[model samples]
Target: MRAIQITEFGGPEVLTLADLPEPVAGPGQVLVDVTRAGVNYADTHQAENTYLAASKLPMVPGGEIAGTAGGRRVVGLTADGGGYAEKALALEGALYDIPDGVDDMTALGLIVQGATAWVMLRKSVHLEPGETVVVHAAAGGVGTLAVQLAKAFGAGRVIATASSPEKREFALSLGADVAVDPATPELRKALIEANGGRRVDVVLEMTGGTVTDQSLAALAPFGRLAFYGMASREQPSPISAPSLLRHSTAVVGMWLPHVLTLPGDIMRRAMTELFDLAAAGTLKVVNGGEYALTDARSAHEALRSRKTIGKLVLDPSR
Candidate 1:
């Protein structure tokens, strides 16, 4: 089996293609013939050993796989991160049967990015109908889905923030009511204005640092901000109990991996609904680009460059 291996912690340059022995599934796991592997921004952090969880060296970096197992088409997370290969190990309980109407790329999108978007809104924040929501990085994988899902969940207004005019337009095509530039001189006021001069009810924030700070400032009383990822790799000013209490705002953190550990079928339910929505043409899956398995480094470069939009995947068969 050919796989992209990382022997040292660094940047995308560390990813190298190598022919390795096929991975064998142990108890409670199955071997998936990798067809498509989802590439996430977190994978870039995983490559550099800077993610939420420490990553062991000499390992494969992909987490999501959409392929066949036991003669059944499935999509799932590679718990130990080996989905960049021709074959990888996947937990049986974590696998979801891909719907007939959903293609491999769309199914792959639902695994991590889609699930994260869903759980952040439906579970972490408990978004209410008619609530005004702001989605950051609106053209990216999770942001794109979050924008559409926020509307599907009956949000009164969806304000999307992107870095470029084109990306903002793309977000608008996905049902975002307003698209503002996160890099604007006055992001906090921009967001509030986009919401018709009102502090938003909910904010799906990922880019940390100043964007997170401004998003926090634009929160309404009793509003919730779902802080998921720190794409900027910069720390935001620490929030104090006094400040939160004074503003009557809530800041909730979400990591999909941790959310998956909870007792219920959150991931599965989210995946199922996301797949169904994509299958029914109610949701859109934007493809940034697909890279060959050996071109994993290029995928990482593109994702980190912040020049690409939507979900990126690797075709193992290539």
Candidate 2:
């Protein structure tokens, strides 16, 4: 099997294509002949060894995969890290049968990015109907889905923040009521103004540092900010309980891996709904770019550049 293995922790340059022996499935795990794999922001973090969980050395770089197992089409997360290869291993419980009408990439979208958006809106923030929602990085994979999902969840308004006009326009096309530039001189003001001169009720925030601070400032009373990722790789100013109490606002941290561990069908339910939406064409799954298995490095470079929108995948068959 051909795989992208990283022996050292560093940048995208560390990901190298290599020929390795095929992996055999152990008990409770199924071997998947991978056709496509999902690339996520966390994959980049894993590559740099700065992810929430530490990654072992000399490992493949992807966790989400769309493949066939036991002659059945499936999409799932690899138990450890073998998704960046021609074949990988996944727990039987982790894999989901792809529904009819849902393509590999669409099913792949729900595994991580789509599920993250669903949990962030439904569980983390507990979004209510008619509440204003703000989605940052609105042109990226999770952002694109969050914008549409917010609207589907009956949000009164959706404000999208991206880096460029084109990206913002793309966000608007995905049901964002308004689009603003995250680089505005007064981001807080811009966010509020985008929300019709009122603070937002819920926010899906990822970019860290100033964006976090400004997003917090733009929150309305009793607003909830779901802080998920720190794409900027910069730390935000310390948040104090007193400040939160004074504003009656909450900052809830959400990680998909943690949610997947809870004793419930939360992840399964979310993935099923996301897949159904995509299959029904109610949700648009943006196909950012499909890179050949060997061009995994190029995919990482594009993601790090923050200029690409929607889900990026690697085609193992390529």
Candidate 3:
């Protein structure tokens, strides 16, 4: 099997394509012939050995794949089993049967970013129908999905924040009631203005850097903020302890890999709804260009640069 292997942690250059032995599925695992693999910022953190959990050396970075196992079409999350290859090992229990009407890209989008967006709002915060939702990084992978899912989940108003006007427009087309630049001075005030002078009820905080402080300040009374990642790779501003007490607000953090461990049917249920939305042509995935499996280095560079919008996936057959 061909794969991009990392024997040492470093930059994207460390990801070298090599002919590696095919991974055999062990006890309850299934060997997946990979079709597409989602590229995420977590891959960059794994390459640098800076992720929350230490990445094992000589590892494959992609955590989610849409492919086949035993002739049954499926999508699976491999956790740490090396998905950046032509073949991946998927836990049999983790496999989701891809329906005939759903395409691989939609399935690919649903597993990682799609599921993340679904879980955060549907399970984590229990987003209400009329709540004002704020989504940061609203044009990126999970951001785009989060924007769409927030609307589907009945958010009354969704304010999206992005770095560029084009990206902000993209978010608006995906159901955001308003999209604004987060780089503007007094970002919290800008977001509040974009929300029609209302404070936020829920926020999806991805790039923590300065957005963390700004988003927190914009939270409504009894609001909740789901801090997921620090894509900026910069330490976020610390929250003042009194801020939460002042407004009866809450701050919650989520890491997809960690949340996947909760023993329950939440993932399956949300995933089913996501797929149904996709099949019905409701979910809009921006699908940042697909690259060849061997071009993993460039893919990582593109993601790190934040130039690509929506989800990026590698085509092993490309």
Candidate 4:
């Protein structure tokens, strides 16, 4: 089997394609013939040796995949690495069957981002009907899905923040009631005005640093802010617990890996619900682009540059 390996932690140039022996499934694991691999910010973080701890000299970096497991099409997260290869291994519990009519790229796109958004909206914050939400990075992988899920779950208005005009337009097309440039210093004011001079009920914050402070100011009394990803790459600001107490607001952290470890029935039910929404056309996965396995380095560069919108995938068979 051929896989993209990072022999050293550095830039995209360090990712190289290499031939490796095929992997055998352990007692509780399943060997999957990977058709598509999801490219995420976490992959770039691992490439730079900043997020996950450094491994041996060489390591595969992909984390999620959509493929066939024991003749059944499925989507799942991988515990270890090696998803960048044509074949990979996944724990039996991590795999979920893909719904009919969903392609490999779309299914792969949904596994990580869809699950993240679904859990955050339906479980983490427990968003209520007619409540307003502000979603940061609204055109990115998780953001796109978050916007749609917020609307489908009965959020009265969805305010999205993006870095570029194209991204803002994309978010609006994805059902965001208002889309604003995240670069603006007065983003909080813009959000309030967009929501008819009212603060939002919930804020889905993916970018940290200054944006975190701004999100706090944009929340309504008793609103909940769910912090998921820190794509801004800036130092985290000190949070004021007293200020939160004064406004009766809350800050919640979300990580999908922890939620997936719940009882088997819960995990299965959540995944099944997301797939049903997709199959019903109430949810959509925007495929930013697909690249051949050998082009893994280019995919990393695209993600780091923030030039890609929605989810990107690597086709191992290509």
Q: Model 2 compared with the native: what TM-score?
A: 0.98
lDDT of 3 by residue, 169-235 (tens): 9888889999888888899899888888888899998887788888888999999999888988888
When 2 and 3 are scored with lDDT, the better candidate is 2
Whole-model lDDT values for every prediction? 0.90, 0.91, 0.86, 0.86
Regions of candidate 1 where Cα sits further than 4 Å from its true position: none
**Whole-model lDDT, candidate 1?**
0.90
Model 4: lDDT equals 0.86
lDDT of 1 by residue, 190-255 (tens): 999998889999999889999998999988999899999999999999999988987799999999
Task: List, residue by residue over 44-136, the lDDT tens digit for candidate 4.
Answer: 878877663555567987888889987899888886877999988887888988878988777776778888888888878899999999999
Count of steric clashes across candidates, in order: 0, 0, 0, 0
Best by lDDT: 2
Candidate 2 per-residue lDDT, tens place, 117-200, comes to: 999999999999999999999999999999989988899999999999999999999999889999888999999988888888
How high a TM-score does candidate 3 get? 0.97
Ranking by lDDT: 2, 1, 4, 3
Give TM per candidate.
0.98, 0.98, 0.97, 0.96
